[model samples]
Target: MTVQHEPDNWRKSSRSQNGSACVEVGSFGDGAAIRDTKDRAAGYFTADRDQWSAFVAAIKGGRFDA
Candidate 1:
């Protein structure tokens, strides 16, 4: 998925204790953008609302554990 416009309100994950290994999330009208906190210039990936919801659900369900 691609974001049609630049996302706003970029913020890092609350779980980020140290700055080394973290990601930042930004919000657009239709979806969200995620990028490496250590490398903002590397760009970001976007996901539509549904895809983002599913991804979050999977994470909460431990689908990505390990």
Candidate 2:
């Protein structure tokens, strides 16, 4: 998540290895854009910088423990 990127430079996570069932992330200004690798034309889900950072932080901190 520390990497900076230009628009449209989508990259799927390296941890993804289960067929095409994964997502891709790309930078959009200080924010980011995400889309399904299985369906590129399905549109995207976006998050601004703050939201993106918080989300990542939560994951790293295990705030989503089930």
Model 1 TM: 0.84
Model 2 C-alpha RMSD to native: 5.6
Best by TM-score: 1
lDDT (Cα, 0-100) at 41 in candidate 2: 83
lDDT of each: 0.85, 0.85
**TM-score of every prediction relative to native:** 0.84, 0.78
Give the clash count for model 1.
0
Prediction 2 TM-score vs. true: 0.78
Model 2 agreement with the true structure over 1-42: per-residue lDDT tens digits: 675454568888788897999988898877899888889888
- Which residue pairs clash in candidate 2? none
Give lDDT for model 1: 0.85
State model 2's lDDT: 0.85
Among all windows of 10 consecutive residues in model 2, the one with the lowest summed lDDT is: 1-10
1-66: candidate 1 lDDT, tens digit per residue: 943777768988676797567888889677789998778899999898999999999999999999
**For each candidate, how many residue pairs have backbone atoms clashing (under 3 Å)?**
0, 0
